[model samples]
Target: MGSSLSTPGASNANDRPAVAATLPPAGCPMHRKLEDATANVSPPPSAETNIDPRNNIPSLSQNPAYGQTIALPLERMRSSIPRTLSDLSTASEHESASTCPMARGGPSRTTEETKDTWVYPSPQQFYNALVRKGWETPVQAIPVMVDIHNWMNEAVWQEVLRWERRYFNPKQSNLALEPEEIPEVSLARFQGRPQDLSPKARFHMLLGRIFPNVYSELPPFDRHDWMVRRDGWGAEEQDKLHRYVIDYYSGADDEDGNPVFHFDVRPAIDDLDSLTARLQEWARIKRETWLGEEQSSITKDAKINN
Candidate 1:
């Protein structure tokens, strides 16, 4: 029986003589039929396929779904193999995230942005993006404040809508181009107080708004409030601060008919004339800076076009 499997010529005793007689010297039909029948016979089991009766050897003839799943050997292998060094799978366990993270669009290093690496889109790009996101108006009176303490906060999205609406109806806002209404929230979290930013914060906001030329390194100078900080500065800084204070409190009054300039550091900047002079100078410098930048940008652009 063993010899019959290995040798084409070997046959069982009862049919040996008849089989030999039917076989022709040169490839007869009977011989061809015999060869065809045995052509796909599997090789003897080795260590890899050393399956026992307890093991389920998946057969295509017995099972055919999903067009086909893994072959019996591979199925057993997939169940048995360990993936990483930390995997405690012992030739048996298979389930959950341990299979293959990469196969399922797992964390892609190539596509993810790094920490503190978000490059802001340009104003035009930002407006376009907002429009794309279904915002009816994408313009804003000011940059939207987006610092939220937690995921539960729903105010951020509302703020975006408010900002967008203000673009269409600038006059609807209580906040003037010069910031008549001071909101107690920081447009950015870094302003220390989330709301009602310090004088310093207000200054930067104004600066950025007015001078649209250098959006890169150069700070902003909005047409509105051009100053911040009532304290913490030397002669020039303090002088400018005092002048801003005066202008900011220009029209209000108290019960006794005194001015409503009750902010701290008023004592330090009592010189009205010097404060006025410094404020005037600050305004002049700010205007000149914006103009200079605008001119330089126009010239640079012309040169490029030429």
Candidate 2:
């Protein structure tokens, strides 16, 4: 059925020319008057004006340092100069909300989403960089080397004394031999804080307090007793070897290009690898024999000066 409505003019004579010439085609809903269709359409640019999007993009070549802004974290990491005290202080205030960094905070950004790249320390180059930057010796700051030596000596004597007392104590029997009690005494100071101790000292003390007699058989600590092999052939062996180095051979180095401290204190034997294996086996056994361990505030030679 066609529309019964007609234009509001004298067109009822049916002699009016077909409106298709001036109106939208029949059944074409989308067709609009040309004037209305073009009201919002922008006028075409002149021949002199270029409107291509590719041409309109701002030119980056205008910037003198385009694409050269380096990341502060990456910059600091790539350069091994030990961060300064001021840097640490600034870092402490950087983002207190974070507890993400494994090592004491160097710097941090409050985000779990980041592009992280690990910087494997190149010992010689790193130290050299530190020297160039005038980094203070760790002894002045952390006393890692000195305290490690001191802790080892103190540990040996404490264990020896404990064993002596235990051996002669009236407490005797098969059950007593494997008694469920471990002696844990700090030989550092009477009231000295263990947390205030150096890195190496702290490490030893924690392990000592945790496992007293387990490390008693740990042969006398000597700096030169064991040599850490850098690596072995094959990726699997190399990964194992790298992990061993990271575990035992700390990053601290002497000017002679040698490790300052050695935790893998394997005694000199025909085969060091075999000796280390034996020590691990002995440690595992001692660990199994251990019972409840505790920390006591007992010092070796602390005297109150009043």
Candidate 3:
């Protein structure tokens, strides 16, 4: 409902280390290592780097519906500014594969787990990701950045859940009540083509420029194609690798002075069924939204006539 993952009760973004499903809290050797690094390092001044321009305009009260013209299959979720890592549980866990020490955040709920549900990365991993990308980030700010990164991933997965609703709960009846029906959709593994622009993204760029007012959103800060598996569906659909597109967009800071971010998440139209579902989902939402508006207009007209 909210535009960004930073919204109240939502988590921040990005992928990190993988560990066992249940992580231990405190007394973790890895946790201590991370703390030691933080204390020892007299890092550069912390600043919000790697930022993208966001719209200063106020966000809509509810999620915006992509009208009939936009045929792409996409669902969006917003996150409010990220909280500090300390605000999270101090829990620690087994050492991750990072050469550098790092702490563990929450466990992921994605359907696929190469080595159990991957835990969000610690400050160390966050730092590594930035440096690996050639961004000169301050070590002192890694903790906060990690929290934001990890929370963004959580937000992206939430959008995946909205798409899975069609697969898991085709009935579209009582979706709010049927939490168990929705499948856990998480990043099975990163496909690693960050440089390549997805088809959906290219279309967004072309269309956005053509109609600046209608599609004026900024280009995604990052794009990830997640390979997910659906084993329960029938033979044709079963075990098929469905690639999902996640477009991360950073928005203007919220009233709290924390950056607002949005993820445009949806499944690629790899197959006929998926393509149909994408259009169907958009039509469903558009119709529902338009119906409400129409009903309100009719009521107002009647009152005015009276």
On residues 1-306, what C-alpha lDDT tens digit does candidate 3 reach at each position?
Answer: 222211111112211111111111111111223323333333432353321111111111111122212222111222221211222222223323221112222343234322234444344443443433334344454444444454545545645555666444444532353556544343333433445776766766676678765554355556666666543345554445677766555544444454444455667788886676667655554454456433212111110000
Candidates arranged by TM-score, highest first: 3, 2, 1
Tell how far residue 276 is off in model 2, in angstroms. Answer: 11
Error of 3 at 260 (Å): 1.7
Q: What lDDT score belongs to each candidate, Candidate 1 first?
A: 0.21, 0.23, 0.39
Off by over 4 Å in 3: 1-115, 168-186, 234-238, 293-306
lDDT leaderboard ranking: 3, 2, 1
Residues 1-306, model 2: lDDT tens digits: 001011111111120111111111111011122334232223332355322121121111111121223211111112121211222123222221110001113444354322222221222222222222233222122222222323332332332233223322233411134433332211110111112322333354455566674322122121211111212123433222111100122222334444332222122234554445435434433443354233223211221111
Alpha-carbon lDDT of model 2:
0.23
lDDT digits (tens) for residues 90-188 of candidate 1 = 122221111100001112233322111111222232222222222332133102211101110122222222222222222343224343432211111
Best prediction by TM-score: 3
Best lDDT among the predictions, by candidate number:
3
Cα shift from native, residue 182, model 3 (Å): 4.4
Residue 13 displacement (Å), model 3: 18
TM-score of each: 0.14, 0.17, 0.55
Superior by TM-score: candidate 1 or candidate 3: 3
